[model samples]
Target chain A: MAQTFSASELKQIYDFALDLGRRAGRILIEGVEKRTGDVGEREEGGVGGGQREKMNAVDIVTQTDLDVEAFVKGEIERVYPGHKFIGEETYSAGSSKEYLIDASPTWVVDPLDGTVNYTHLFPMFCVSIAFVLNHVPIIGVIYQPLLDTTYSSLVGYGAWQDDGKVGGKRKRLPLVNGPKAVLPREAPKGCIFSCEWGKDRRDTAGGNMWRKVDSFVNMAAEIGGRGGKGGMVHGMRSLGSATLDLAYIAAGSFDIWWEGGCWEWDVAAGIAILREAGGLITTANPPANPETDPIEEVRLGSRLYLAIRPAGDSEGETGRQAQERVVRETWKRVRALDYARPGA
Target chain B: MAQTFSASELKQIYDFALDLGRRAGRILIEGVEKRTGDVGEREEGGVGGGQREKMNAVDIVTQTDLDVEAFVKGEIERVYPGHKFIGEETYSAGSSKEYLIDASPTWVVDPLDGTVNYTHLFPMFCVSIAFVLNHVPIIGVIYQPLLDTTYSSLVGYGAWQDDGKVGGKRKRLPLVNGPKAVLPREAPKGCIFSCEWGKDRRDTAGGNMWRKVDSFVNMAAEIGGRGGKGGMVHGMRSLGSATLDLAYIAAGSFDIWWEGGCWEWDVAAGIAILREAGGLITTANPPANPETDPIEEVRLGSRLYLAIRPAGDSEGETGRQAQERVVRETWKRVRALDYARPGA
Candidate 1:
């Protein structure tokens, strides 16, 4: 059983989590540099004897991952003695989707969200931590140690960024760091978007791999679907970090992010931060009939999400209206992908 | 005829260019922030009176790009009055491919290399500068303003990075800031590669856009054309900046980069820096007969480049040999794209 904590109690946990995240980030940064030149294990000789763990050919894991998960779990356990937990490292075999469906007040964590990138010394990975109440992500914190940046928030509170000394400023989310967003209704022509080429390259029919190929072609095609001309958005990028991709959208650095096949841990913390920043997160495909399929039925494990950055009133339409138009337009382009919640 | 100078004279130019890059970077950073929150012009309202120029839906020009180009050109003219120049903003309209064929000592400049990225306020853009002597890049400097990182080198001299305060280090390339390179024979599986979905989405039979789709599928396929099964490499990324992409390869931050359709200005500086770092730059597709084709003939504007980071003898083979093996293997995977030099 999980204990029901008051808002004040949750805030305390949130504060502790942020500090824990920064310390964990330091550990990750140190480990990352060590692995950069250590690619020998897979080839001929490697950096003497570094331990390399692979959950799959493309999905890699490392000692740092296990160490970080242990640290986060230990810290949470020490503070909230009765809380339930779901984490990437401790995830039981064959139960990838089982743990995330419950309505408990559990801590969902992906101590290292972009392991492949981390192994390659790429700088886009993050440590994602979230507190979910009755299946809702209520508190979230994501820290990218290499860049010394953090994105955090509580459900009803706002999201914030502590962008270390180089940037030299603390900021609210939807980062006022750049120009206000310009989202045109014809997405492919006016917006910059992001998606991932996930590791699962099982190319069977209905297997996620072929769908990605089709999406890339359709999105970049000179023409749109079935007889319609394409929206021809500005561009698409695959930066390899799910946590940062979500956080970037939340910060309004990107216009939209559409992805499929990432699990709950990949999105739990980000959903909280994104929502707090006034962004919208929807299933990659819209409800077949808006009146018949309620948006409330969308779940984290649905494995497909289309996120949009919030706009300000300066762009002619209200921010919400702009977000809706972009989403509706984008949804039309992606009608081929089916990401409906497993049973709903 | 163009003036020929001693190595010392080139060094002076290199030092000057580095300083110029820093100054230009400061100007870009200033302009970038001003444009943030200024996207109102396209829709209804916008950031008050700031000029926004769009060469196309995907290519944008800002006052800063023009200002930086003029600043660079003026400073060069003041110091070296007779040098010829080729720049993105001033490329005498309609002759994009005409200027690079000559052998004059010219200053090739891409004042803003990733304009679309800059316009979207994405952080992958850079200021790329190179001094080409008789079609050979002799001095190069690339500065990424937002990150405050500078990558520079003179041909035959080594590549170096002034990583600024955030990194608090000055170092030689392949960034012995970490481990030495470890390249494996199975290119895709061992290396993290990068390319671009460039704005030229022509979809014609011999066009660039459709080839990207074919290459992505072939590279990520479970099996190859030859009898062997597929080589599923770690992953591919599209970071949106051709200049930085090559610079990162020079720094050994990424293992391989295969790209086409970028111009001389886009690659000249990076080519010089990469060569200085002891990396290999080859055409994306191998010659019909490697025994008869000389690698040295690969040019800056051939527009199809396949680059790999050099490795150390500690990794079983020498860096050059490792580069050859990976390139050979990767070349086998990409038979769909035709990037043979136009008259070679």
Candidate 2:
């Protein structure tokens, strides 16, 4: 019924998938610059919440958002009709929230990575898609249309981009320099760090977010001889786009990025892109396996990821140790808002 | 004796000084593209303890950085040489602590802002220069070399910039789209916000920088519709440079921006630029005039500032109310962070 293929066949499939990502990126870029592609309020259609649930503070959705998901889903279906395809809007619409993620070579698509930035005409958004076989991201493509940059990665093959844009194109996501740049150098002590303003208010049960932000900014001010107190991080930035944020880390454009409260669709494609760019993605708490499966870990929402561009070139073990230190220090700074999460 | 001049004469002086800001910006852009600037690290001359004692950052001190500062200072001196000049490197080299602000019309300059980005070839930094009269930012000039963006503002001149870059041919900073675009909206349940990470940390005594970051990010997350639990403030972002971050708000690129640990050099000129765009800048707590001496109540060394561009351009009465609401809401967020600064 389905056409099965060999290793070469898989390579061809990946190549085609990469082409599709580029094409989609072009379409998105053209759409953004056009006045016609505006998401004006639909006064014509009565306000309906079903089509778009409150994603969070400062975020909204629409049928078009869902339509983009469907478009990508269909594109994958048309190419590899037998290959499993999973996307966000469909999951929200369907009864199964599992995403049906299987090891049997699936394509993960996040049609719109930063919906909030898109709605507001902010330029730090992207379209992310990943192809995986045996639960490893064999091929990944991430495109930020507004910024006109696309990042892609393939298993063992390595990660790269079209050219320098958004977060620079890199062999590894960050392509971080050596000891003078990475190890022995102490990770610059102070620099620009990134993360989104996820939920979990200090007034809530999941107050870890509040604690993290507080410690982060304070640390940023004091760190790195940037003119404040600490030299741990110079600055902390959040661009509202997981795809672009993670891309920044892989490209070595940004030093580090820690995130939580995101779905697989939000980070799946970027994860591969970052890893390919010589970056490491780890957990926020224990700081392990940034590439760990997005399973429901304590919370059912279960989508948290921490990505960093280590200074080491995988040969040296210092980067790993630096990452470990960062996590421990960050945890020490966090003072749990709600004390509900297990780690707290 | 200091040469005495009328208030309008002071305004003329500001005009001439801002002229040099644009010129400095041009040179900076060329320097960046050509990478043709010379970089020199100072010999670690000054010895001051307490905090600046442990400097862990390596700044790219270049001719471009100094040339711009010197040029701006020269222009000011040519018009009124008696006025003092405070710059990033000059301040530390000359004085151990800080220069006197005793009613002197001082020019604070940060030549070649975003040097790290400039060196690494990222394009988000700019040149910031502010004219402080007796403490308040009387006039300011900010320019992003690459973007050809120049913002000039005086206490009463209403602030403006040269649009589309016609070789220093200045024009009133046009309000984007609607006049409201120049104004700060009610931080829609889901809007885009911007901030920066300064050199602050939890380890520093009496400095709640860590808490500030946590609260700020949490506000972005918790402000309503999507990521957080109840509220929505759309999205949050942080571009590395404080001047550019403020300029973004003035250009209606961002709704609100909050920062601390950033020196007056980073934001003094930006504050004028934001206010010129009909925005509000004030202390994060105690809600007072950030333009004057209220900075003392602002938790010394912790430079907390909140700026909100008013939407719907109503400066007479309603505009004041809009400014009040923004300040209040910003205060509310700060309070949230303060409570969470030490961590929840």
Candidate 3:
């Protein structure tokens, strides 16, 4: 029953969504500094008076996330009333099996991507919205309000960043002093890498994930040449926010971020920005016998991610090769972990 | 004999040292980023031209660190003339017990605190400068230039933060925005907690840390919770820089961070900041015999660490008691590994 929109309409629609996303971000910023000192009713979120919606048992979902999502969903519905939609906490009840198995256009959203941080009052979460067409993600926008950074792209506009500044002084991002000057380079060991724990409570993939992370630490410090004892990894860091993690990579804050078990909504926006910054996103664990084109299957919630910064001072191929090496190392690390002793 | 001076003279000495530290930081930042991204060079830091000065295998001593120390030493001579100085990379050159071993007022500096991060281009590193009064750190200033975060304190006067903003004014921080707000009355099953790699790279400690992290995840989503599957650790993050890690604890971004194998200098400034932010810093692994003292033991390089936000959120008398139950549960998780087997 949804009406299909043209390409120009789609860009305009996404642009509108970005506006609402920024507004929501501002509200969150104001609320975080307010509700986060000493004590407040925001804790024990309840259905009753003074209580906000609490996600799961511990995460405190504030009016901010709810308010933000409502505003976001409203704008989407208003512009494209007939389009199919899905959201994190609220959309589940109305979700159908068709979206997963069908070939229709659908919109997926995680308004406040890092919900726990939002609830606990940590500041790095983001607003993620993606448009999928015929089962392929074609339009995405990842906006992190706190840092005032935005990543967005339409199938071929190429990826770029817009400093989420107020008003419309949209500056095309990566403010690269030069284009094509950037390239992917070898991932330096002894640097911080980012990862997360997906909703899988059972320790199935948890154990394996830990092994991979542990090996990453060793590799980073081992390369640093610390005598007494230190992994080549300089240090390992998990910032608790996907949007910011990718932004940092774009800005050259953290060297590499290998992660898994995240949804497309979580990465859609950042993907655009990372790409704009000249980074590559690949599968962390592609099968040894991959299908004809395994790259086509990479999706959010697929439990695999490897993103490397496109080096700023080298040839493009160098950057491409560097990212590939990191991908291979991540796999090797995984394999090493697989063969590691049971106790490990 | 080492000369001693008044606080005013010490202030001048510190200023001079700070200048040297900044110069060293700039050198490191440039090398890590612009030089070349080589994981091998990172892992095996050999002598290189332009800003790099390699030491022996398992260790790297950049010219920046040495130059900074020399500048600091010269300034110290200019200000206090004979103040004793001891540095990490320079310790081996002398056997004189008078500097490190003997109890004398000394300036202990980790020119590059997170050296591996420096080598690998990871941003979780710092310049640690602690003025030890007779081997006890009295005045501490840990500067993370890349992030423009400066944590400084002189015992009596409270701690402060100078945002990474180069030209920005110094801000009296905890930004208090201080202390974590108390959890809502009915807290969720699992909350976000952070754990990190200890200097001890043993499989047992490594396995134990993961078990503890897993316990938090399982506790969060414990089945029957909305949006949670039994394990729901909001998120796990590691920034690689101990200085930054501890600083985040002080800043309240991290709810809890458990670490091991760090020194007094590594924590002194942040511990003060964490306490100022109303957070608790305790032993990650409780001693067989519990002690209720605010500070304990001469075992920093060997023991584990546990830093919790809002210092006194839990009603229990000790951090050990708060996390003790989880520790027991973690034992079984480690059983699969021989190093973690009983009666090692």
Candidate 4:
């Protein structure tokens, strides 16, 4: 039998996660400020000092990442006692190379998503916290300090965004309040596409990197280019933060977000929010044969994922059908990428 | 002989530009809100209505864009009666397609950049204004309404940013105050690169679009991939806005911004801010030969531009030399693109 969470219990967890995410956000902001010399004494400079400074910036990110993870872990353990926790930093520091997600209530966290953006002071990093029960994320919170925005969601409950203004209202997700958002007539052609170039940059023949580049070009090319594979999406955006990418999709700003080579923690919180906001998450690649292979729901452990925004009725199709249509159209334009988890 | 303005006069102009930018920003915000149904009544829905709704959204952007241009042009002409004006919408609406930039004191403006982002409510659009004297931008203002931030600069004066806080202190450009910033040891490696895929989606062989796609791959691939043509940059970000891209380079968050298929109004303001912040702007492509063709300064009319962030002394080289080295290294990895202006 599975353990069930009540609505009130989930609300408590959501509040806790929101609080924890904001606290973690402060640490990230402070780390960036310290690194950029916004709040502390300046570091001494010398000839050939660029390398040292670069190392120092990396150190700040690492330290802040560790600090946020430790703080969140400690708080969760103290409050929830026996709940399990899996964090990016902790997992990387552990000796065990393999792990499993069983029937356990667990917390998955990316203490600092977009570390590169953090180091560069690009203002797109965030703290993402997700509570999973039996391999399903039920509670999510993602806080962006620089933007002062908070996105939160609970299973069976709708997602919400706090715009971080004094006395500001917390708006429901899919932000189009009353009416349902209708997909563009041509779908992907008028859609805003968002994707990230992850850490893997290897470009071997038919490698993941090659597939990504090819797919991006295909999507941005003219409608008749590349033998009709061109999508000619309204825009292509890479914000370097998968968390924000998913959040934006949930907000209905980004029409689609496809990504590969991201860890579970990077997408867990975002998945919870996206699903609750009426968005869909599926495999990044399409079925090998539509006549035979059915589209699969992306698992938490899947290294590749595709997210589509919430849609309303369009062309005699329901919202779900519209989303599926978009997914299929997008899949047709992109090459399938292979990204296996370590020791999977 | 030419007319030269005094420092005090330039300061007055900068202040006026900043004020005008903020006002234009408000109009942009209102337009976005109105289109998103945040500020106005909802529209009636119908079956298969996606195309009509999209047209409505595009109408909002066009109306807002024209409104901003008209507003800015009116104020500028009223204040500086004898100053010449060239705006994105005005130029497009005029009968003559050819434009000339002589020695006149002129205002060049892109009332709204990133219209696609605006229609999608992606929050990266802005109002850009530049005052050009003798074919050089002397005062620049770029205002981002969604972020409530302003970036302004004047020739012979430093670039500054106001963080849109109540009583927030204005900070200098490069955002690193005390000490100068140093470029990474293997710059282009540890640098954050920003670029845009403009409206030109035509992918002809040996054309600008193909070159851009190839260059992006080289820049994002592993250092040895593509037969050592790879750059392996820290990250590649496409925010879909050239004006903000250049402003970010000036702010030191984005280390490099290489763009093509943009207009004089799109870059004039950003160029002034970047130059004022000790950054460098040159042609997007490299010179023919290291010993022969010298690097040329990017003109206001140069549709292609490459911008590098402000750098301090590094590796026994002065700040300017360090910037030049990064530019050359970046140029080595990217293919030269040709974006000829209409009737050129």
Candidate 5:
């Protein structure tokens, strides 16, 4: 049986996660700002200004990433001694890539999401913190320092965005005044689609990279183009951060987010937030069996995710049915991508 | 000969444009907010709510767009009676699009750039205003109301970003404290590239859509992949706003912006701001003759543009040379595109 927490206990954990996320955000902002300053000095011909040669863009592991992860891990351990912790930095450090999640009170954290955006000073990086109990995420908090925004949610409770002002009012998710609109009849054709070109860039035939590019083109082409596989989405946005992509979906700004290859820490917090806002998540690709439900097959460590925003009842269809319909439509345009977690 | 304005005259114009942009932004905020509310009501099953069926994403012309343009045009005409004006809404409404620019003082404006984003409630839209004299952009101001940020510049003067606070200090463009860094030796390899899918989605063989997707794939694939034409860029971002993309280039956040099929109004303000920050603008496609300079071949009316951020100096090479070198390298990977203005 799944363990459950009282509402009061969940609130306490959510509060702690929000605080921790903000602390991690400060570290990210400071690190990126310092790096920006260092780059400026280098351009101005300053010698020995703490500048290190970046080996490559994809492999930019800054001291800040380590620092933020370490700080968050230490705090969680100190505050909740009985809870387990799994972080991106620590997980990557270990050789084992088997499923780290289990039926326990655990904290999954991505200390610095959007590392490339951070390195480039793109101002989209964030700190994501999620608390999972019994293999299910129960609380989530994501803080973007530059934007001074925080997105937080608790199981059985709604999501909210805090603008980080001293006396600012927190806005409820789906930010719309009432129920969310149902998915458009044309589905992806009128939807704003979000995805990422992740770290893997191999272009072998039928490889992850090729499939991802093909999927993007199929979604972007005209409706009748690409041999009838075109989705012709209203817009395609790649913000380089899975956490923010999910947060935007919860905020009702992004209509859909389809991604593969990201780990649990990247989506755990986002998933919690998205779910609280009435959004749904399922497998990126359709199930082989015609009658299988995609949502039932999705796991936290699945690595492939297709998320849709809340769609309330419209045109004689239920909100859930509308979301499922759009998901099926999107799956048709997407070429299947294979991304197995280590030891999966 | 190009007409010149005194520093005092330019400053006054810049201040007026800034004010005009902010005023227009108010209308946009109101319009989007009202629409969000209306949609909420419709979703909640409220009867007779103010809702209209949108025909398509590319052609979402909200009343806000027309209102902002009318207000800005009226304000400009009132302030500078002798100056001419060309705006996105007005231009689109007119049947003729033959080189609207002339060697005269004029104001080119996109009252609402990123119309799709705005209609979808994405916060990346902005009001762009540019002042041109003798076919040269002299002053530019772009206001993003959602972020409460403003980017402005004057020819021969510096560019600045105002955070929209009553007493907030305006930061200088290229926001770094010192000189800007030169392009990476690997050119687009370490660059953060930004582009738009645009309104045109025609997919004929070798058409604009195919060429764009091919170019994007080439830029994103691993180096030495795609038959030795891969760029392997660090990150790819599509914010769905041409104006903000160029402003980000000026701010040194976005390293490169390669776009085709945008209008003069979509880029005039951003071009002035970027040039003031020491950035470069050139043709997106290579010139036929190897000896021809891409920068020299580019004109204000050119539908294709490739822009690079300010690069001060590095590794014994001048900033100009570094920029030119990157441009040449990028050209090798781009597929030529054709986008002619009507009646051109």
Candidate 6:
């Protein structure tokens, strides 16, 4: 079951994905702008699987989303035949947690990660493409067309970002890049915390939605709450775009992105870039210290994640210690309710 | 005291503010980029009034904020010798609420609205500038240099936006412009809700922090709470930029912006844009209808505002009715705990 591709061959595939992702992102931005004007008259209800147009309060699938998935799938197949595809718009039903069990080269794609934002013309959506080999996200690319920024990473090669405003120079993650580590500040003090309330508002107790609300309250509560342990974060932000959330954390703009109830495609690209940029991704479950846990223990499709940006340059031992202390202290106060479905 | 200026004179002042705002925004952006790199090692404590370096859990004041305010004030004085000014970085202590009572043509400015975000390099800060005559915001402009987008409006002239993308075309607001009005959908049901956890995190009951937590929980709660009314919004967003929040709602991207614990300068510019775009601004307090009440009833300096985007064209009486119904229903379920201090 050993992989047959050489390092050079893997690099070639990574280059292919980076180019294809950028092209698909441009298509998404253009299509979204053209379609935003007509959203006024579009009916609210629909159903979907393959371009199956479905609409709901939390999630919506537009033709553009499906089209982008198909286009990316087609492009990937053209470049590398026999590579399996797992895309959001056409993801198989009842494939939770075990979808990545097949040990083949798979291209995981969330052609439009933030479909809800895309529909609202919120400018927070993105195209997330990742190449997974042996269940590992080896190559990842996330392109945000509105911001004209692209984040990409090849496993072991490190993460990089190309911002349109900076003359499209590909800045290696942490801004300083290389030998310099980029440490994050303590939570709720100087940190910009990111999370989302996914569209799963079941009224039942211990439900995913219920837990998210509880967690948000706890994270935002005052430092010393009335007879409670409040995380007292500096601020809370929900931009409605998960891929960008992970990408931003990787880029050092956001200190942490805690998410749950999302699939593998939603985070694969971001996870790859994050790790490459010297960040760590762990379960959102509270009291779990990111400093001590090996990131390899992080379950890919656990539907929960707590991603922390790298502490600044490796040389500053004190700064790095402070960053880790924040992560530990923040986790001590966080209590994310379990979202695992019954008998999963 | 009736205003002495004619319509033409007011237009001239508005034009000058727009030009000044754009120039000031560029300077802020340049300064921010230059300063973001050094934030890593900058000592995290200081005190502030006029460029008094200060740091706190919620608010951070950098030199750039004070510099930008001074630059804008200087530019305005050179253009009109006697116009009074009230700006965030320079406002007198304890005069936060009553600074706008003067009947003169006063320029209200928040040189940097999202100081915390700016300090964190989060890109949610902006330059908010408004010209108020007789305590009425007659012209407003909000510029986000990071995105290079500008939202501006002159009373009676309507709202407009110039996105740095799309070849910098100055598209009129409401997106539809002129005859058509673009309305927002119902809240917590496909609606994008925006709010902020401002820097008033006093842990005491009935304090700003306590009240914000209560409101957020209520808004995000299930439609039929166990024993209480729930706002049940589609999703919640806290981008930490009040000016951008109001400007985005005025531009029709955000459906609603519910804010409290902010100042007049934070929202005056956005109020002008919202009104000019046919949107409605009312108190964040629930059960108050903007339709029956005069726009003047919107207490600008009250530090509490609830703004809603219009629903499409006015021709469809049924559509307009539906829009109003949503707002009314939303208000009924909203219960923002009062944060005003006793005998203020």
Question: For candidate 4, lDDT tens digit of each residue in A38-127?
Answer: 211123342223422333666677888999999999999999997899999989888874545666889999999988777766767899
TM-score of chain A of 1: 0.84
Which ranking of candidates, highest DockQ first? Answer: 4, 5, 1, 6, 2, 3
Q: How well is each residue in B277-342 modelled by candidate 1, as lDDT tens digits?
A: 778888876567544455654577777788877564435676677777777766766644554444
The best candidate in terms of lDDT: 4
Q: What is the TM-score of chain B alone in each candidate?
A: 0.85, 0.74, 0.64, 0.91, 0.90, 0.82
TM-score of decoy 3 = 0.65
Output DockQ, candidate 1. 0.24
Candidate 5 per-residue lDDT, tens place, B63-160, comes to: 67888999999999999998899999898998887778888889999999988777666668899999999888889999987766889988766777
Q: What tens-digit string does per-residue lDDT give for candidate 2 at B1-344?
A: 33356878877877776677878777776554333122122222110111221222233237667777777777778877678888875764663553344466678888867776665444567788887776667688887664465777776666565533223334343223233242345443434567655543555444565455444544555545224323356666777777777776665557777766566677778777676656767665534442232322222123567776634434454654655665565555553223222110
lDDT of 4 at A12: 91
Residue B5, candidate 4: Cα error in Å is 2.0
For residues B1-344, what per-residue lDDT tens digits would candidate 4 score against the true structure? 44788899888888999999999989987775564432111233322234223336667778999999999999998999988999999998877756566688999999998877776667678899999999899899999887777888988667777767323446567764223378777777878889888777887988878888888888888887878888888889999999999998998889889988788899999999999888999989767753346668887787889999987774577888888888888888888888776543
Candidate number achieving the greatest DockQ relative to the actual structure? 4
Q: What is the TM-score of each candidate against the true structure?
A: 0.84, 0.68, 0.65, 0.92, 0.90, 0.85
Give the per-residue Cα lDDT of candidate 3 at B216. Answer: 41
- Worst lDDT run of 10 residues, candidate 6 chain B, spans B45-54
**Per-residue lDDT value at B197 in model 6:** 75
lDDT of 4: 0.81
Q: Write the per-residue lDDT of candidate 6 for residues B243-311, one digit (tens) a residue.
A: 888887876667777887777888999989888776778777764553464333577777778887755
Q: A153 in model 1: Cα distance from truth in Å?
A: 2.4
Judging by lDDT, tell me the better candidate of 1 and 5.
5
DockQ of each: 0.24, 0.14, 0.13, 0.36, 0.32, 0.23
